[model samples]
Target chain A: MRLADNYEKNGDLIVTTLYDYARRIANQVTVVKDQGRDWDQLIDDLVTSKYFGYPLMFLLLGVVFWITIVGANCPSQLLSDLFFWFEGQLTFVFQLVQAPEWLYGLLVLGVYRGLSWVVSVMLPPMAIFFPLFTLLEDLGYLPRVAFNLDHLFKRSGAHGKMSLTMSMGFGCNAAGVIAARIIESPRERLIAILTNNFVPCNGRFPGLIAMSSMFMAVGISMASSSLVSALVVASIVITGIMITLAISWLLSRTLLKGESSSFTLELPPYRKPQVITVLIRSFFDRTIFVLWRAVKVAAPAGALIWFLANITVGEYSFIAYLADFLDPLGRIMGLDGVILLAFILGLPANEIVIPIMVMTYLSEGAMIELDSLSAFRQLLLDQGWTWLTALNFMLFSLLHFPCGTTLLTIKKETGSKKWTILAAVLPTIVGIIVCTVIAWIVG
Target chain B: MLMIISLDQLPVGESGIVTVIDAHGLTRRRLLDLGLVPGTVVKTIRKSPAGDPIAYLIRGSIVALRVNDSKQISIKPFSEVAINE
Candidate 1:
């Protein structure tokens, strides 16, 4: 007790002395220029103003998403076509080499398709999103966002730095998990990691967008469909944030009990973002790294999926049997058996969830390509989807467990399987509860 | 006698000379890193939308600290410090 008191006193003394020295030097040397008006006044007035800050943030983020959605379309299509063409060439080469049928099925049909799906679907958006976010980071806007949201986080009993991690989660949860390092307190850091998955990452955005465009945009014309979809997506993002705060509050109150430790954050001066460096770094560091990990898991997942679809016991294949088993539970959750099976299989990458569902519904027993969103909608309609199904599916997609790469990141970050397992199970439990409740109510 | 007040109590647009930082170990270290040391002049810039956390210009950086955290550090308003000296 004496030693603890001494330590406390010493800390106080250090702070006093440091302040004293800083004041003395500041008084003697500090100079002011442009006395009344500050250099950053305009930007600060706009960016941090109570009314404008939020609107500006939304507008900027919307612009980024707009560019990503519009810019990524052609490239995504081009890549998909190129990969599919290559698949044909690979099959021809296999036939020429007299490769066995099962070998071709496993290697070419299953693994190659899986790898191609991940690369094509996952690459374009991440390639566009990360660099844009990084550009904002470079401009020093992110810290201001952190600054603005700090109070809410503090009130939630979480470290203010969580705002930064939450924004990073918009790109990828693994990146967000890594970004949690900014939180100094171990307890608060854990809260950040555990709650990061609440935000919809790029991987899940396609699924969310598809559902919103199909259901929410019904009766809206073509031009405004995009706007309606954006609004719906924005609402879902807000819901994710609310859930993040709620979970953070619960964890702080229950498991990680402590005062949310205060930290000094220097709101650095905004500068022009360096485009070249930002692009290269985000491309190689974030885009490539996340894509590579997804592919690694996806290839094996594809092989397993193929085996599940192909291996028939008596009459029904394993996937069909599994979906049948899950059908009752899925109905309670307002999703079909095929949808549930797709989610279970989509464990490797959230990007594959819709594809897996489409594949399952078609009874192809392997992942297949969809020609367009309308065709995808037609498949869902044929499966007997209502607005409730679409809503619940989107809810499930938003709230479900993070992908395999994100799970590995959580394990690596916490260095404790206990926390990692909790991280995985927490969201799944929340997803099931929320979806079930919604389903129960709508019924 | 020096008229000391919690930094959060300092009026908007007024500057203060930090005198004592009465915070726990972790918070103290963090405050110091932000240049909240004794002799620095911090000016209150503005309040947030919710009006609890106030932005203060400290050591050439604009920082927003919640009232709860700001209340831990004691400072003398510029006029009070000038009169005392």
Candidate 2:
């Protein structure tokens, strides 16, 4: 063991010597052929060039998000229609069998409605976004994103690879926390894990996209509304990234103080991404995995929400009392009590926040499917929602604590109660501060 | 005598032969494992827009090294070395 330790002490020298010998033998034995066109280097030069690099990165990212928003709408509508139609059939059967009122309400109206809302609203975006993102990863573009953004990250005293993990956060914060494994430094990894929630994941994206589109539709033309909303969402993403850097900087200076570790990132040669493999892998791996988790959480949450909405005390249901209790705090944050309740209940999965809000607003035991965005907007308006409310809700969604799955992942990854708790607390504090400040100014 | 400079000081599109690596412990080992030994040819490819970590062609692969790491690697310009030869 001592001899092995001694060898390990001089491991670098030994590896250098071995490489020297291998190079010498290979140089003598082999003839090298020069490729006429070095396409890889050419593309790298263009993409990483000073003038074009940042623009190209933002443009590509914007295009992906734009496609996701536009492409997801039709499928989301179709799935919603099909699921509600199925819900109608189930209700018919329940009536035909003369099932107990409470049983039918809980099973079909509550649990089934929540599950269907989650699936229809959440699936199409994930299905579209993950494959597009995976295609970029397969094409070796993600590392270049890290490469371009490394300087900013380094300035914030975090590893450059934090950029890659943040990209994963766009899909899911739990996945993002796991991807922090790429950062070898414990300090930076913790920073990445704690701040990953700043980026709104796929679960939150459906809500953000919906709200932002509505926010833009007021004054914008139909032709430009989608584009404007895409830009709005993009800016929110940028804001989240800014918050990530700010918090990373704050952590390094205070709680997790350390010098940024040295890292050598290889800019792998871009490859022709295999389309078939990209689709299948992204579908089964990311879309299905995340959907399953959301579905699992949504059912229990649905039942709980139904119970809250159905079981009344005096004149109001439990949900109304809870919302009334939270009203002052929510009002301070430029949101209503129901919105706050939705966020609290959304702890399990962000995908169900909107549905919960809808269920509570109607004060019904079950969730109702909104026929259109205009009708949705009208409902919110009737409930005293304003432009500021929508804006704060979007901002809150972007800045708030990660969902329950992410907290579990952080605990498992850090294995420390303090850091896991900080991971949850840090972002929530930031969200509260931001929302309160916005409401104070606007109110 | 050829003037030796740190790798980060080498201009983009310039080629240099490494002369010494002034790093230790895991950092030193990592640099060596990446083929940054004495006499290896390294070329600066480009700079990221924010311009701290620079990409270089090392051992036929493009690798990005932060200024902190690259500044520790000393190199002699290949143009000057060829003239000396």
Which numbered prediction scores highest in DockQ against the true structure?
2
lDDT of each: 0.80, 0.85
Candidate 1: residue pairs that collide: A19-B37, A19-B38, A19-B39, A20-B38, A23-B39, A23-B40
Stretches of model 1 off by over 4 angstroms after superposition: A1-39, A87-104, A178-181, A364-369, A408-418, B1-3, B79-85
TM-score of 2: 0.93
Per-residue lDDT for A1-443 in model 2, tens only?
67856665577467778888988998999886656227877887778888999888777777887888788888988888898788889989999999999999788767887788778877887889899989999999988888888988998899888888998888889999999998888889988999999988988888888887776557867667778777778778888999999999998999889878888889888889999999999999888987898788888888888888889899888898999999999999999899999999999888889878876786543334565556677788878899889889999998887888899999999999998888888888998899999999988
The stretch of ten residues in a row with the least summed lDDT in candidate 2 chain A is: A363-372
Q: On residues B1-85, what C-alpha lDDT tens digit does candidate 2 reach at each position? A: 7799999999999999998887776777789888888888999988888787999999778899999999999999988899999
lDDT of 1 by residue, A82-164 (tens): 98889989999999999999999889777887677667766887888789879988988887777667777887899888888
Q: After superposition, how far is residue A53 of candidate 1 from its true place, in Å?
A: 3.0
DockQ of each: 0.54, 0.80
Q: Clash totals for all models, in order?
A: 6, 0
